[model samples]
Target: MTQPDFSQRLHGIIPPVVTPLKPDFTVDESALRRVIRHLLDSGVHGLFLLGSTSEVVFMDAPARREVLRIAVDEVAGRVPLLAGVIDPTTDRVIAHARDALAAGVDGLVVTAPFYTRTSQAEIAEHFRAIRVAVDLPIMAYDIPVCVNVKLERSTLKQLRREGLIEGLKDSSGDDTNFRLLARECAEDPDFRLFTGSELMVDTAFLVGAHGCVPGLGNVDPAAYVALYDAAMREDWTEARRLQERLIRVFNIVFQGTPRTSAGASGVGGFKTALKLLGIIEHHHMHRPNLPLNDEETVRVAEILRAEGLLPAQERKLVPGV
Candidate 1:
């Protein structure tokens, strides 16, 4: 495949979309479409399918392809679509990349190989091999919390310099390291850098992040977009207000912690919040992961109400919660 010219910088509030599910654990097509439409209608710059927030690791190849197909159909290219070709090995990721290409995604978000330990050099080669196979622009997902190995700044720089990746999704929680990289790559205007931290988007923008991929974006996309707009206008005070409001909204993710695993807590909270906000029908999560209970659901509602996301007229409470 001839490499497409990725000259256009993918900047702005691109959300990592949530995969809404039926109680039977099947993809709820209507709910999913509603969620996609919600994000797009809110003027989100782009949509990221199959990210950690999307529960990509819980899905098989065919399910992932189906989700991408639905997203492509729903979007129809109104904005750029970055597909998460996340898998355990290089060849596996390449396979997903081919599917994403066939599905007509604008870019690929990849990560260091998980479930197997590899050195920084091997990790570098992993990304290189994928780039060798796929022509789509790539974004290195630096999420050490889940993958166990950090995509060190040096390896990321090497990938960027060698043209293996066009951007980064920094979820490693290392602000200093992220700042250093944002400084090092300051000259490359096309190298889009995004922060996965929903709470620190204001600070990340201060350090020159091109955009954000917040999980909370699935719950409240407009606020993220508004925060981005405020930052672009250099309105730090408004940006800080919006960011703090989002931080409070983020409290929903903890409503189910300890009882639920970390992944379930975060994703389930978003799903539950979406359900309460009347965007999705059910808050069901992927199998082997528990959904938020009624008590937790009530707490999520309280957080939404506190954030003013839940209004009296539009209140839709889950039965018995």
Candidate 2:
């Protein structure tokens, strides 16, 4: 096969799509394709599967490959598809990377291992090895909150110097790091940098970052697309306004859910909001994570309605318009 035209291959609203599961907790291939088509129809630039938002960490190897195949097939050249290569072990990550490439994915997004914190040097070595093992373009995921190792500016530079990594998705939610990266890799235009934080979409655009890979885009690809379009047109006001609305939706879905003694995480909230929007069959969460309660669901609906995202009296129309 020929080399992928990376310049033409990346950029814009790449949502880390949610992995829809059936009641039996098996991968729902049909629903997965539906979601991908929905995002593309809504105008996302690319599709991302098995990323952090996809609950990839909980998936085994077979399940991972199946999702990748589903993504590659469903996308069907209408848009590029990328898959997560985040594994706690280096060998597994290498294997997964090879598999993703062999499956004909456009690129790979690899997260630093979270189990047992590895030193910066060790982390650097890990990425370098995988870069050599796979021929696909790699985007390093720097979500320090989950993965203990933060992708240091110096380490990123070193990896670039060694020709091991091509891009980065910074979830550190730090503006300083973004500005530093823009200056450091200023010459390498193909060295893409994406903001993983949904809230920082505007800021990242301002700092010369290529685009975003937000989880929220799984539900609201329109908002992110509008934001990116606004940025390209230099419409800062409209861009910020759209971004704020997305932040509001995120806040409601993430916080309205009640917490258990173990403390609440927002994966359930995200899925619940999707269910409310009729995007998924049910707000089915994988094992060990609970679904949203009735109260949270009502609140999420209220927020969506107030935001005018769902049908209201004004936007409402008779059947078939």
Candidate 3:
């Protein structure tokens, strides 16, 4: 399984596709298929399943396997599918990586260990181990807020030099960090870099990022597609105008929530907004954190409606009616 030639095709918007669960918390296969179809039709460049937005943190092994199978089968090469392998232990993470690859994922989106501090050597070892185990393109998920380990410039360049990793997802929300990483990897045209922050889409492109995997892209896929097009076309005025609208919605979703749990709410917001758009069955969320309360849901509805992301006709279809 040679790695895909991502050097040419990796640049674009790839949403971390969320998992749709039934009322009993089982994977909603039909809903999952429908969401992917909707996203692809809506114009996301690729589909990345089982990533953080899919609550990989809370999903069990069997559930993860099922998701990989369903995504691979349904997508069937219509677009690229990268399964998210987010485990705290390197050995177990390697197992998941091999399994996901066998299921026909186009690439591997992996993050370093979390909860405990791991040295840079450990981080490098974790990624190198996976690279050796699977022959797919490895996109390092450098999200320190969740993984507790950040892939700095030197480490990424080291991995690139060794041919052990191909690209990185810079979720650190630091423009300077991405700038440094971009500069360090500038010489290696094959080493792709993506920004995980939606607000910084323009800045990331300006700094030589390959693309973005933004949470908001789940709700505003067409808008994001347009932004990417404008940027690629060098139309800064159009891209900035669209990004401002996205940033407004982002600020609302992130407000009054702890940083760790902020992404959880954003995932919920995407599902909620999806329901409002009449694109899904329900705005269902996995347990332990119930779907947003009525007031919060109403507020999210109001903000999206105001932004024109949600129309009045569709807002009536949300759950908790």
lDDT, candidate 3, 1-321, per-residue tens:
355555567778999887888888888888888888888888888888888888888898899999989888888887778888888888888888888978988888888777778988888888888888877888888888787667777887788888887788888877887898888778877788888888989878877887889878888888888988998998989989989989888754653255326666778777776666666666667776556556666777788878887666544533462
For model 2, what is the error of residue 52's alpha carbon versus the real structure, in angstroms, after optimal superposition? 0.9
User: Per-residue lDDT of 1-321 in model 2, one digit per residue for the tens?
Assistant: 223376456889899898888888889888887888889999999888888778888898899999988888888877778789988978899999988987888888887767878888888888888888888777788888787768899888888778777788888877898899988888988788888888989988987888898887877888899999999988999999998888887765465334631213356666666766777776666776766667666666677778776666432211210
The ten-residue window of minimal lDDT in model 2 covers: 312-321
* lDDT value, candidate 2, whole model: 0.79
Best by TM-score: 1
Alpha carbon RMSD to native, model 1: 1.7
Whichever of 1 and 3 has more TM-score, that candidate is 1
lDDT assessment of candidate 1: 0.90
How high is the lDDT of residue 316 in model 3?
A: 51
What is the clash count for each candidate, in the order shown? 0, 0, 0
Q: Which stretches of candidate 3 lie over 4 Å from their true place?
A: 255-260, 317-321
Candidate 1 residue lDDT tens string, 49-156:
999999999889888998999999999988888999998899999999999999999899999998999999999999999988987889999998888999998898
Candidate models: Cα lDDT each: 0.90, 0.79, 0.80
Alpha-carbon runs more than 4 Å astray in model 2: 1-4, 256-264, 313-321
